[model samples]
Target: MVRNPGRRAALVDAAVEVLARDGARGLTFRAVDGAAGVPNGTASNYFVSRDDLLAQVAGQIHQRVAPDPEEVAAVMAAPPSRALVVELVEWINRRVAGDRTGYLAMLELRLEATRRPELQKELTRTIRAARDDDLRFHRESGLPGDATAVRLMYLAMTGLMLEQLTLPGVVPAEETQGLISALVDRAIGPEGAA
Candidate 1:
Protein backbone atom coordinates (compact mmCIF):
# COMPACT_ATOMS: atom_id res chain seq x y z
CA MET A 1 0.00 0.00 0.00
CA VAL A 2 2.96 2.31 0.63
CA ARG A 3 5.36 3.13 -2.16
CA ASN A 4 8.25 3.51 0.24
CA PRO A 5 7.42 1.08 3.00
CA GLY A 6 10.28 2.40 5.07
CA ARG A 7 8.61 5.75 5.56
CA ARG A 8 5.44 4.07 6.76
CA ALA A 9 7.50 1.96 9.12
CA ALA A 10 9.18 5.02 10.57
CA LEU A 11 5.80 6.54 11.33
CA VAL A 12 4.71 3.35 13.05
CA ASP A 13 7.85 3.28 15.17
CA ALA A 14 7.36 6.89 16.14
CA ALA A 15 3.74 6.23 16.89
CA VAL A 16 4.64 3.42 19.24
CA GLU A 17 7.02 5.62 21.23
CA VAL A 18 4.56 8.48 21.38
CA LEU A 19 1.71 6.21 22.36
CA ALA A 20 3.71 4.58 25.13
CA ARG A 21 5.12 7.75 26.57
CA ASP A 22 1.88 9.65 26.50
CA GLY A 23 -0.65 6.84 26.93
CA ALA A 24 -3.85 6.70 24.92
CA ARG A 25 -5.56 9.50 26.81
CA GLY A 26 -2.68 11.89 26.32
CA LEU A 27 -1.74 11.03 22.75
CA THR A 28 -2.54 13.70 20.20
CA PHE A 29 -1.68 14.44 16.60
CA ARG A 30 0.69 17.24 17.55
CA ALA A 31 2.26 14.97 20.14
CA VAL A 32 3.08 12.29 17.61
CA ASP A 33 4.31 14.94 15.21
CA GLY A 34 6.75 16.17 17.84
CA ALA A 35 7.74 12.70 18.99
CA ALA A 36 8.31 11.61 15.38
CA GLY A 37 10.25 14.78 14.55
CA VAL A 38 7.98 15.15 11.54
CA PRO A 39 5.96 18.19 10.63
CA ASN A 40 2.54 18.24 12.23
CA GLY A 41 0.95 18.00 8.81
CA THR A 42 3.20 15.13 7.83
CA ALA A 43 1.72 12.66 10.30
CA SER A 44 -1.83 13.58 9.33
CA ASN A 45 -0.95 13.47 5.64
CA TYR A 46 0.63 10.02 5.86
CA PHE A 47 -1.83 8.49 8.26
CA VAL A 48 -4.71 10.12 6.38
CA SER A 49 -7.05 10.13 9.39
CA ARG A 50 -7.03 9.74 13.15
CA ASP A 51 -8.41 6.25 13.02
CA ASP A 52 -5.89 5.44 10.33
CA LEU A 53 -3.06 6.54 12.57
CA LEU A 54 -4.40 4.54 15.48
CA ALA A 55 -4.83 1.48 13.30
CA GLN A 56 -1.28 1.69 12.04
CA VAL A 57 0.03 1.85 15.60
CA ALA A 58 -2.14 -1.05 16.62
CA GLY A 59 -1.05 -3.02 13.57
CA GLN A 60 2.57 -2.47 14.43
CA ILE A 61 2.03 -3.84 17.93
CA HIS A 62 0.36 -6.94 16.51
CA GLN A 63 3.21 -7.39 14.08
CA ARG A 64 5.64 -7.19 16.95
CA VAL A 65 3.73 -9.78 18.99
CA ALA A 66 3.14 -12.26 16.21
CA PRO A 67 5.94 -14.78 15.81
CA ASP A 68 7.56 -14.62 12.45
CA PRO A 69 9.66 -17.50 11.18
CA GLU A 70 12.81 -16.25 12.85
CA GLU A 71 11.20 -15.83 16.27
CA VAL A 72 9.45 -19.19 16.12
CA ALA A 73 12.68 -20.92 15.19
CA ALA A 74 14.53 -19.14 17.96
CA VAL A 75 11.93 -20.08 20.53
CA MET A 76 11.71 -23.67 19.32
CA ALA A 77 15.46 -24.09 19.35
CA ALA A 78 15.89 -22.58 22.81
CA PRO A 79 16.48 -25.91 24.70
CA PRO A 80 12.85 -26.48 25.76
CA SER A 81 13.83 -26.25 29.41
CA ARG A 82 12.05 -24.28 32.13
CA ALA A 83 14.79 -21.68 31.86
CA LEU A 84 13.87 -21.15 28.25
CA VAL A 85 10.37 -20.25 29.30
CA VAL A 86 11.73 -17.67 31.73
CA GLU A 87 13.78 -16.23 28.91
CA LEU A 88 10.78 -16.03 26.67
CA VAL A 89 8.76 -14.36 29.41
CA GLU A 90 11.56 -11.88 29.90
CA TRP A 91 11.58 -11.24 26.19
CA ILE A 92 7.87 -10.52 26.11
CA ASN A 93 8.16 -8.31 29.20
CA ARG A 94 10.84 -6.24 27.52
CA ARG A 95 8.76 -5.78 24.44
CA VAL A 96 5.84 -4.55 26.52
CA ALA A 97 7.99 -2.33 28.73
CA GLY A 98 10.03 -0.99 25.86
CA ASP A 99 7.09 1.17 24.88
CA ARG A 100 4.33 1.39 27.44
CA THR A 101 2.71 4.25 25.57
CA GLY A 102 2.52 2.15 22.45
CA TYR A 103 1.17 -0.79 24.46
CA LEU A 104 -1.52 1.41 26.00
CA ALA A 105 -2.36 2.78 22.60
CA MET A 106 -2.83 -0.76 21.39
CA LEU A 107 -5.22 -1.43 24.24
CA GLU A 108 -7.18 1.64 23.20
CA LEU A 109 -7.10 0.50 19.62
CA ARG A 110 -8.47 -2.87 20.59
CA LEU A 111 -11.32 -1.20 22.39
CA GLU A 112 -12.06 0.99 19.39
CA ALA A 113 -11.84 -1.96 17.06
CA THR A 114 -14.61 -3.58 18.99
CA ARG A 115 -17.00 -0.97 17.55
CA ARG A 116 -15.49 -0.80 14.09
CA PRO A 117 -15.83 -3.76 11.79
CA GLU A 118 -12.78 -3.18 9.61
CA LEU A 119 -10.46 -2.76 12.55
CA GLN A 120 -12.03 -5.77 14.19
CA LYS A 121 -11.42 -7.84 11.09
CA GLU A 122 -7.73 -6.98 10.95
CA LEU A 123 -7.33 -7.66 14.66
CA THR A 124 -9.04 -11.01 14.28
CA ARG A 125 -6.81 -11.98 11.39
CA THR A 126 -3.70 -11.04 13.31
CA ILE A 127 -4.72 -12.94 16.45
CA ARG A 128 -5.83 -16.03 14.52
CA ALA A 129 -2.57 -16.06 12.61
CA ALA A 130 -0.70 -16.04 15.90
CA ARG A 131 -2.86 -18.87 17.25
CA ASP A 132 -2.16 -20.91 14.15
CA ASP A 133 1.56 -20.44 14.63
CA ASP A 134 1.21 -21.72 18.18
CA LEU A 135 -0.75 -24.73 16.92
CA ARG A 136 1.98 -25.44 14.41
CA PHE A 137 4.61 -25.47 17.12
CA HIS A 138 2.67 -28.00 19.15
CA ARG A 139 2.16 -30.15 16.10
CA GLU A 140 5.87 -30.21 15.36
CA SER A 141 6.92 -30.99 18.92
CA GLY A 142 5.29 -34.44 18.65
CA LEU A 143 5.09 -34.54 22.43
CA PRO A 144 2.11 -35.58 24.50
CA GLY A 145 -0.02 -32.63 25.63
CA ASP A 146 1.75 -30.54 23.06
CA ALA A 147 -1.52 -28.83 22.31
CA THR A 148 -2.14 -28.19 25.98
CA ALA A 149 1.37 -26.89 26.52
CA VAL A 150 1.00 -24.51 23.63
CA ARG A 151 -2.30 -23.19 24.96
CA LEU A 152 -1.03 -22.83 28.49
CA MET A 153 2.10 -21.18 27.21
CA TYR A 154 0.07 -18.43 25.61
CA LEU A 155 -2.09 -18.07 28.69
CA ALA A 156 0.89 -17.81 30.98
CA MET A 157 2.60 -15.35 28.69
CA THR A 158 -0.47 -13.17 28.70
CA GLY A 159 -0.76 -13.44 32.43
CA LEU A 160 2.88 -12.46 32.86
CA MET A 161 2.45 -9.49 30.62
CA LEU A 162 -0.50 -8.41 32.69
CA GLU A 163 1.50 -8.87 35.84
CA GLN A 164 4.31 -6.82 34.43
CA LEU A 165 1.91 -4.05 33.62
CA THR A 166 0.16 -4.32 36.94
CA LEU A 167 3.33 -4.36 38.99
CA PRO A 168 6.41 -3.75 36.94
CA GLY A 169 8.67 -3.77 39.98
CA VAL A 170 7.78 -7.28 41.12
CA VAL A 171 7.85 -9.73 38.22
CA PRO A 172 10.98 -11.46 39.42
CA ALA A 173 12.78 -13.97 37.24
CA GLU A 174 12.06 -16.74 39.73
CA GLU A 175 8.32 -16.22 39.33
CA THR A 176 8.69 -16.63 35.61
CA GLN A 177 10.56 -19.89 36.13
CA GLY A 178 7.91 -21.16 38.49
CA LEU A 179 5.13 -20.29 36.09
CA ILE A 180 6.88 -22.17 33.30
CA SER A 181 7.51 -25.22 35.47
CA ALA A 182 3.90 -25.30 36.61
CA LEU A 183 2.59 -25.01 33.09
CA VAL A 184 4.89 -27.74 31.87
CA ASP A 185 3.78 -30.04 34.65
CA ARG A 186 0.13 -29.39 33.88
CA ALA A 187 0.72 -29.97 30.19
CA ILE A 188 2.99 -33.01 30.29
CA GLY A 189 3.30 -34.13 33.90
CA PRO A 190 6.73 -34.82 35.45
CA GLU A 191 6.97 -38.34 33.97
CA GLY A 192 6.38 -37.21 30.37
CA ALA A 193 8.64 -34.18 30.57
CA ALA A 194 12.36 -34.24 29.96
Candidate 2:
Protein backbone atom coordinates (compact mmCIF):
# COMPACT_ATOMS: atom_id res chain seq x y z
CA MET A 1 0.00 0.00 0.00
CA VAL A 2 1.10 3.58 -0.61
CA ARG A 3 2.35 5.52 2.44
CA ASN A 4 1.62 9.04 1.20
CA PRO A 5 -0.87 10.50 3.68
CA GLY A 6 -1.81 13.40 1.44
CA ARG A 7 -2.53 11.18 -1.54
CA ARG A 8 -4.49 8.72 0.60
CA ALA A 9 -6.60 11.52 2.08
CA ALA A 10 -7.28 12.93 -1.38
CA LEU A 11 -8.36 9.55 -2.67
CA VAL A 12 -10.65 9.03 0.29
CA ASP A 13 -12.26 12.42 -0.19
CA ALA A 14 -12.78 11.76 -3.87
CA ALA A 15 -14.32 8.39 -3.01
CA VAL A 16 -16.77 10.19 -0.73
CA GLU A 17 -17.89 12.42 -3.61
CA VAL A 18 -18.33 9.43 -5.86
CA LEU A 19 -20.30 7.57 -3.25
CA ALA A 20 -22.53 10.54 -2.59
CA ARG A 21 -23.19 11.20 -6.26
CA ASP A 22 -23.44 7.65 -7.56
CA GLY A 23 -24.16 5.37 -4.60
CA ALA A 24 -22.17 2.27 -3.64
CA ARG A 25 -22.32 0.44 -6.94
CA GLY A 26 -20.77 3.37 -8.74
CA LEU A 27 -17.91 3.70 -6.25
CA THR A 28 -15.20 2.37 -8.55
CA PHE A 29 -11.49 3.12 -8.29
CA ARG A 30 -11.70 4.71 -11.68
CA ALA A 31 -14.49 6.99 -10.50
CA VAL A 32 -12.46 8.06 -7.45
CA ASP A 33 -9.37 8.65 -9.61
CA GLY A 34 -11.33 10.81 -12.02
CA ALA A 35 -12.94 12.72 -9.15
CA ALA A 36 -9.55 13.31 -7.55
CA GLY A 37 -8.13 14.43 -10.88
CA VAL A 38 -5.25 12.04 -10.37
CA PRO A 39 -3.80 9.30 -12.58
CA ASN A 40 -6.18 6.42 -13.27
CA GLY A 41 -4.38 3.95 -11.01
CA THR A 42 -3.64 6.35 -8.18
CA ALA A 43 -6.61 5.28 -6.03
CA SER A 44 -5.82 1.64 -6.59
CA ASN A 45 -2.30 2.33 -5.36
CA TYR A 46 -3.59 3.88 -2.13
CA PHE A 47 -6.41 1.42 -1.43
CA VAL A 48 -5.97 -2.34 -1.25
CA SER A 49 -9.48 -3.06 -2.50
CA ARG A 50 -12.96 -1.60 -2.95
CA ASP A 51 -13.81 -2.46 0.65
CA ASP A 52 -10.66 -0.72 1.82
CA LEU A 53 -11.63 2.39 -0.10
CA LEU A 54 -15.14 2.27 1.37
CA ALA A 55 -13.73 1.95 4.89
CA GLN A 56 -11.45 4.91 4.36
CA VAL A 57 -14.30 6.94 2.95
CA ALA A 58 -16.46 6.05 5.96
CA GLY A 59 -13.86 7.42 8.36
CA GLN A 60 -13.34 10.53 6.28
CA ILE A 61 -17.04 11.42 6.24
CA HIS A 62 -17.16 11.41 10.04
CA GLN A 63 -14.22 13.80 10.21
CA ARG A 64 -15.76 15.96 7.51
CA VAL A 65 -19.02 16.24 9.45
CA ALA A 66 -17.62 16.58 12.96
CA PRO A 67 -18.24 19.76 14.91
CA ASP A 68 -15.59 22.46 14.87
CA PRO A 69 -13.74 22.47 18.19
CA GLU A 70 -13.62 26.26 18.38
CA GLU A 71 -17.37 26.47 17.93
CA VAL A 72 -17.93 23.88 20.65
CA ALA A 73 -15.68 25.80 23.04
CA ALA A 74 -17.55 29.04 22.36
CA VAL A 75 -20.87 27.36 22.97
CA MET A 76 -19.61 25.75 26.18
CA ALA A 77 -18.59 29.10 27.57
CA ALA A 78 -22.27 29.80 28.10
CA PRO A 79 -24.02 28.46 31.19
CA PRO A 80 -25.59 25.06 30.65
CA SER A 81 -29.33 25.25 30.21
CA ARG A 82 -32.12 24.05 27.95
CA ALA A 83 -31.23 27.02 25.82
CA LEU A 84 -27.67 25.78 25.61
CA VAL A 85 -28.84 22.31 24.61
CA VAL A 86 -30.99 23.89 21.91
CA GLU A 87 -28.01 25.84 20.68
CA LEU A 88 -25.86 22.70 20.60
CA VAL A 89 -28.45 20.75 18.66
CA GLU A 90 -28.84 23.60 16.24
CA TRP A 91 -25.10 23.68 15.73
CA ILE A 92 -25.04 19.96 15.03
CA ASN A 93 -27.82 20.30 12.49
CA ARG A 94 -26.00 23.13 10.82
CA ARG A 95 -22.74 21.21 10.68
CA VAL A 96 -24.37 18.24 9.01
CA ALA A 97 -26.38 20.44 6.70
CA GLY A 98 -23.34 22.46 5.72
CA ASP A 99 -21.61 19.32 4.48
CA ARG A 100 -24.40 17.98 2.34
CA THR A 101 -22.15 15.73 0.30
CA GLY A 102 -20.48 14.22 3.35
CA TYR A 103 -23.81 13.42 4.98
CA LEU A 104 -25.11 11.97 1.74
CA ALA A 105 -22.02 9.84 1.50
CA MET A 106 -22.63 8.64 5.04
CA LEU A 107 -26.19 7.71 4.13
CA GLU A 108 -24.89 5.81 1.15
CA LEU A 109 -22.57 3.89 3.44
CA ARG A 110 -25.52 2.89 5.59
CA LEU A 111 -27.33 1.52 2.57
CA GLU A 112 -24.25 -0.29 1.41
CA ALA A 113 -23.80 -1.80 4.83
CA THR A 114 -27.08 -3.63 4.32
CA ARG A 115 -25.40 -5.70 1.62
CA ARG A 116 -22.03 -6.14 3.34
CA PRO A 117 -21.88 -7.70 6.79
CA GLU A 118 -18.33 -6.59 7.54
CA LEU A 119 -19.17 -3.05 6.61
CA GLN A 120 -22.30 -3.29 8.70
CA LYS A 121 -20.32 -4.34 11.74
CA GLU A 122 -17.81 -1.58 11.19
CA LEU A 123 -20.50 1.05 10.84
CA THR A 124 -22.39 -0.21 13.90
CA ARG A 125 -19.29 0.04 16.02
CA THR A 126 -18.33 3.43 14.72
CA ILE A 127 -21.81 4.91 15.11
CA ARG A 128 -22.33 3.45 18.57
CA ALA A 129 -18.98 4.77 19.75
CA ALA A 130 -19.88 8.21 18.48
CA ARG A 131 -23.20 8.05 20.34
CA ASP A 132 -21.42 7.03 23.51
CA ASP A 133 -19.06 9.95 23.12
CA ASP A 134 -21.98 12.30 22.67
CA LEU A 135 -23.62 10.94 25.79
CA ARG A 136 -20.46 11.44 27.80
CA PHE A 137 -19.99 14.93 26.43
CA HIS A 138 -23.54 15.95 27.28
CA ARG A 139 -23.17 14.74 30.86
CA GLU A 140 -19.69 16.16 31.45
CA SER A 141 -20.36 19.48 29.76
CA GLY A 142 -23.22 20.21 32.17
CA LEU A 143 -25.58 20.18 29.27
CA PRO A 144 -29.27 20.20 30.18
CA GLY A 145 -30.10 16.52 29.80
CA ASP A 146 -29.37 13.01 30.94
CA ALA A 147 -28.43 10.02 28.80
CA THR A 148 -32.02 9.24 27.84
CA ALA A 149 -32.64 12.84 26.90
CA VAL A 150 -29.53 12.86 24.82
CA ARG A 151 -30.59 9.64 23.12
CA LEU A 152 -34.04 10.93 22.32
CA MET A 153 -32.67 14.16 21.01
CA TYR A 154 -30.25 12.26 18.83
CA LEU A 155 -33.04 10.14 17.35
CA ALA A 156 -35.30 13.11 16.77
CA MET A 157 -32.56 15.16 15.19
CA THR A 158 -31.46 12.28 12.99
CA GLY A 159 -34.98 11.78 11.65
CA LEU A 160 -35.29 15.50 11.06
CA MET A 161 -32.01 15.62 9.23
CA LEU A 162 -32.94 12.64 7.08
CA GLU A 163 -36.18 14.26 6.04
CA GLN A 164 -34.52 17.59 5.53
CA LEU A 165 -31.64 16.29 3.47
CA THR A 166 -33.23 13.44 1.51
CA LEU A 167 -36.50 15.25 0.89
CA PRO A 168 -35.98 18.96 1.30
CA GLY A 169 -39.57 19.90 0.65
CA VAL A 170 -40.81 17.74 3.53
CA VAL A 171 -39.64 20.22 6.14
CA PRO A 172 -39.98 23.86 5.31
CA ALA A 173 -36.71 25.78 5.63
CA GLU A 174 -38.36 28.46 7.76
CA GLU A 175 -39.47 25.88 10.36
CA THR A 176 -36.23 23.95 10.85
CA GLN A 177 -34.73 26.12 13.59
CA GLY A 178 -38.00 26.22 15.47
CA LEU A 179 -38.36 22.46 15.14
CA ILE A 180 -34.90 21.95 16.52
CA SER A 181 -35.77 24.08 19.51
CA ALA A 182 -38.89 22.06 20.09
CA LEU A 183 -36.99 18.77 19.86
CA VAL A 184 -34.55 19.85 22.54
CA ASP A 185 -37.25 21.17 24.79
CA ARG A 186 -39.34 18.04 24.56
CA ALA A 187 -36.43 15.68 24.97
CA ILE A 188 -34.99 17.50 27.98
CA GLY A 189 -38.39 18.33 29.46
CA PRO A 190 -39.54 21.65 30.90
CA GLU A 191 -36.99 21.44 33.74
CA GLY A 192 -34.22 20.25 31.41
CA ALA A 193 -33.97 16.91 33.12
CA ALA A 194 -34.19 13.42 31.66
Candidate 3:
Protein backbone atom coordinates (compact mmCIF):
# COMPACT_ATOMS: atom_id res chain seq x y z
CA MET A 1 0.00 0.00 0.00
CA VAL A 2 1.19 3.47 -0.82
CA ARG A 3 2.11 5.34 2.34
CA ASN A 4 2.48 8.67 0.48
CA PRO A 5 -0.38 11.04 1.29
CA GLY A 6 -0.33 12.54 -2.23
CA ARG A 7 -0.73 9.14 -3.88
CA ARG A 8 -3.57 8.23 -1.53
CA ALA A 9 -5.36 11.47 -2.38
CA ALA A 10 -4.97 10.80 -6.07
CA LEU A 11 -6.51 7.36 -5.72
CA VAL A 12 -9.46 8.66 -3.68
CA ASP A 13 -10.09 11.42 -6.19
CA ALA A 14 -10.06 8.87 -8.99
CA ALA A 15 -12.57 6.78 -7.08
CA VAL A 16 -14.90 9.78 -6.71
CA GLU A 17 -14.75 10.45 -10.43
CA VAL A 18 -15.58 6.84 -11.13
CA LEU A 19 -18.51 6.89 -8.68
CA ALA A 20 -19.82 10.09 -10.22
CA ARG A 21 -19.42 9.03 -13.83
CA ASP A 22 -20.30 5.34 -13.64
CA GLY A 23 -21.70 4.88 -10.11
CA ALA A 24 -20.76 2.14 -7.64
CA ARG A 25 -20.97 -0.85 -9.94
CA GLY A 26 -18.54 0.63 -12.40
CA LEU A 27 -16.09 1.53 -9.64
CA THR A 28 -13.45 -1.14 -10.09
CA PHE A 29 -9.75 -0.92 -9.26
CA ARG A 30 -8.53 -1.33 -12.83
CA ALA A 31 -11.05 1.13 -14.24
CA VAL A 32 -10.40 3.67 -11.51
CA ASP A 33 -6.68 3.22 -12.09
CA GLY A 34 -7.16 3.69 -15.82
CA ALA A 35 -9.33 6.73 -15.26
CA ALA A 36 -6.77 8.17 -12.86
CA GLY A 37 -3.92 7.35 -15.22
CA VAL A 38 -2.39 5.39 -12.36
CA PRO A 39 -1.20 1.83 -12.85
CA ASN A 40 -3.68 -0.93 -11.86
CA GLY A 41 -1.35 -2.46 -9.30
CA THR A 42 -0.75 0.98 -7.80
CA ALA A 43 -4.44 1.73 -7.48
CA SER A 44 -5.12 -1.61 -5.87
CA ASN A 45 -2.11 -1.20 -3.70
CA TYR A 46 -3.47 2.11 -2.41
CA PHE A 47 -7.13 1.10 -2.04
CA VAL A 48 -6.66 -2.52 -0.89
CA SER A 49 -10.23 -3.63 -1.51
CA ARG A 50 -13.32 -2.55 -3.47
CA ASP A 51 -15.28 -2.02 -0.24
CA ASP A 52 -12.42 0.07 1.07
CA LEU A 53 -12.52 2.14 -2.09
CA LEU A 54 -16.28 2.62 -1.89
CA ALA A 55 -16.09 3.61 1.77
CA GLN A 56 -13.37 6.12 0.93
CA VAL A 57 -15.46 7.50 -1.90
CA ALA A 58 -18.59 7.77 0.26
CA GLY A 59 -16.72 9.38 3.15
CA GLN A 60 -15.10 11.85 0.78
CA ILE A 61 -18.47 12.89 -0.60
CA HIS A 62 -20.02 13.22 2.86
CA GLN A 63 -17.15 15.29 4.18
CA ARG A 64 -17.24 17.74 1.30
CA VAL A 65 -20.99 18.31 1.12
CA ALA A 66 -22.98 20.24 3.71
CA PRO A 67 -26.58 21.15 4.22
CA ASP A 68 -27.73 24.02 1.98
CA PRO A 69 -26.02 27.16 3.20
CA GLU A 70 -28.88 29.39 2.15
CA GLU A 71 -29.57 30.12 5.80
CA VAL A 72 -26.16 30.90 7.09
CA ALA A 73 -27.86 33.50 9.26
CA ALA A 74 -30.83 31.35 10.23
CA VAL A 75 -28.43 28.55 10.95
CA MET A 76 -26.72 31.06 13.20
CA ALA A 77 -29.36 33.71 13.92
CA ALA A 78 -32.52 34.04 15.97
CA PRO A 79 -36.09 34.61 14.71
CA PRO A 80 -35.30 33.83 11.10
CA SER A 81 -37.24 35.54 8.36
CA ARG A 82 -37.38 36.29 4.63
CA ALA A 83 -33.61 36.15 4.40
CA LEU A 84 -33.83 32.50 5.37
CA VAL A 85 -36.07 31.71 2.43
CA VAL A 86 -33.95 33.76 0.05
CA GLU A 87 -30.75 32.18 1.20
CA LEU A 88 -32.23 28.66 1.12
CA VAL A 89 -33.61 28.93 -2.42
CA GLU A 90 -30.35 30.40 -3.62
CA TRP A 91 -28.57 27.50 -2.00
CA ILE A 92 -30.78 24.96 -3.75
CA ASN A 93 -30.39 26.63 -7.15
CA ARG A 94 -26.67 26.76 -6.79
CA ARG A 95 -26.57 23.19 -5.54
CA VAL A 96 -28.61 21.74 -8.41
CA ALA A 97 -26.72 23.76 -10.99
CA GLY A 98 -23.24 23.10 -9.63
CA ASP A 99 -23.83 19.36 -9.53
CA ARG A 100 -26.87 18.16 -11.43
CA THR A 101 -25.82 14.62 -10.73
CA GLY A 102 -25.20 15.29 -7.06
CA TYR A 103 -28.76 15.19 -5.83
CA LEU A 104 -29.63 12.46 -8.30
CA ALA A 105 -26.60 10.50 -7.29
CA MET A 106 -27.74 10.71 -3.68
CA LEU A 107 -31.11 9.30 -4.63
CA GLU A 108 -29.36 6.49 -6.43
CA LEU A 109 -27.08 5.80 -3.49
CA ARG A 110 -30.04 5.78 -1.13
CA LEU A 111 -31.95 3.30 -3.30
CA GLU A 112 -28.95 1.02 -3.43
CA ALA A 113 -28.53 1.37 0.31
CA THR A 114 -31.89 -0.34 0.79
CA ARG A 115 -30.18 -3.68 0.23
CA ARG A 116 -27.10 -2.75 2.26
CA PRO A 117 -27.99 -2.38 5.94
CA GLU A 118 -24.95 -0.45 7.03
CA LEU A 119 -25.24 1.98 4.17
CA GLN A 120 -28.97 2.34 4.77
CA LYS A 121 -28.44 3.09 8.45
CA GLU A 122 -25.72 5.59 7.72
CA LEU A 123 -27.85 7.43 5.18
CA THR A 124 -30.84 7.42 7.51
CA ARG A 125 -28.76 8.89 10.31
CA THR A 126 -27.50 11.59 7.96
CA ILE A 127 -31.01 12.57 6.90
CA ARG A 128 -32.41 12.46 10.42
CA ALA A 129 -29.62 14.64 11.69
CA ALA A 130 -30.27 17.18 8.98
CA ARG A 131 -33.95 17.24 9.85
CA ASP A 132 -33.11 17.69 13.50
CA ASP A 133 -30.86 20.63 12.74
CA ASP A 134 -33.57 22.33 10.75
CA LEU A 135 -36.16 21.71 13.45
CA ARG A 136 -33.90 23.20 16.07
CA PHE A 137 -33.18 26.21 13.88
CA HIS A 138 -36.87 26.89 13.39
CA ARG A 139 -37.60 26.45 17.08
CA GLU A 140 -34.88 28.86 18.04
CA SER A 141 -36.14 31.35 15.49
CA GLY A 142 -39.64 31.12 16.93
CA LEU A 143 -41.10 30.34 13.56
CA PRO A 144 -44.82 29.56 14.03
CA GLY A 145 -45.61 25.90 14.14
CA ASP A 146 -41.93 25.45 14.76
CA ALA A 147 -42.17 21.70 14.78
CA THR A 148 -44.81 21.09 12.12
CA ALA A 149 -43.76 23.81 9.76
CA VAL A 150 -40.14 22.85 10.11
CA ARG A 151 -41.03 19.31 9.10
CA LEU A 152 -43.07 20.67 6.21
CA MET A 153 -40.13 22.75 5.10
CA TYR A 154 -38.12 19.60 4.48
CA LEU A 155 -40.94 18.08 2.49
CA ALA A 156 -41.29 21.25 0.45
CA MET A 157 -37.64 21.32 -0.51
CA THR A 158 -37.54 17.63 -1.31
CA GLY A 159 -40.69 17.97 -3.41
CA LEU A 160 -39.30 21.02 -5.16
CA MET A 161 -35.99 19.31 -5.84
CA LEU A 162 -37.79 16.26 -7.17
CA GLU A 163 -39.72 18.56 -9.49
CA GLN A 164 -36.44 20.07 -10.56
CA LEU A 165 -35.15 16.60 -11.35
CA THR A 166 -38.02 16.02 -13.76
CA LEU A 167 -38.46 19.48 -15.26
CA PRO A 168 -34.87 20.67 -14.86
CA GLY A 169 -35.71 23.99 -16.49
CA VAL A 170 -38.78 24.98 -14.55
CA VAL A 171 -38.79 27.08 -11.33
CA PRO A 172 -36.38 29.92 -11.66
CA ALA A 173 -34.49 30.71 -8.46
CA GLU A 174 -36.08 34.10 -8.20
CA GLU A 175 -39.56 32.63 -8.46
CA THR A 176 -38.77 29.90 -6.01
CA GLN A 177 -37.53 32.42 -3.48
CA GLY A 178 -40.55 34.57 -4.20
CA LEU A 179 -42.86 31.71 -3.27
CA ILE A 180 -41.04 31.08 -0.01
CA SER A 181 -41.00 34.77 0.70
CA ALA A 182 -44.74 34.83 0.37
CA LEU A 183 -45.03 32.01 2.85
CA VAL A 184 -42.76 33.82 5.28
CA ASP A 185 -44.65 37.01 4.69
CA ARG A 186 -47.84 35.25 5.59
CA ALA A 187 -46.20 33.72 8.66
CA ILE A 188 -44.92 36.94 10.12
CA GLY A 189 -47.83 39.05 8.87
CA PRO A 190 -47.72 42.79 9.68
CA GLU A 191 -45.61 42.17 12.83
CA GLY A 192 -42.49 41.57 10.78
CA ALA A 193 -40.46 38.52 11.87
CA ALA A 194 -37.27 40.35 12.59
**Which lDDT values do the candidates have, in the order given?**
0.67, 0.88, 0.65
TM-score of each: 0.75, 0.95, 0.70
Q: Candidate 2 lDDT, tens digit per residue, 20-93? A: 99999999999999999998999989888999998888777888888888988988999988888888888888
Pitting candidate 1 against candidate 2, the one with the higher lDDT is 2
Q: How many backbone clashes does candidate 1 have?
A: 5
Better of 1 and 2 by TM-score: 2
Q: Give residue 76's lDDT in candidate 3 (0 to 100).
A: 46
Clash pairs (backbone) in predicted model 3:
70-87
- For candidate 3, report its TM-score: 0.70
Model 2, C-alpha of 188: deviation from truth (Å): 0.9
Q: Candidate 2: lDDT over CA atoms?
A: 0.88
Sorting all predicted structures by lDDT, with the top scorer first, yields: 2, 1, 3
Can you tell me which runs of candidate 1 are displaced by over 4 Å? 1-4, 66-75, 78-105, 169-173, 191-194
Q: Is candidate 2 or candidate 3 better by lDDT?
A: 2
> Where in model 3 is the C-alpha error above 4 Å?
67-79, 138-145, 165-175, 178-194
Model 1: per-residue Cα lDDT over 43-154, one tens digit each: 7667777678777876788766544578757766855554554455456666676755555666666666778788788877877787787677556654345666777767
Error of 1 at 138 (Å): 2.5
Looking at model 2, the pairs that clash are none
Q: Candidate 2: which stretches are off by over 4 Å?
A: 191-194
**Residue-level lDDT tens digits of model 3 in 78-194:** 444556544554575567657655565565566667777877777778778877976786676655545665566567677777777657567665677666556545544423444
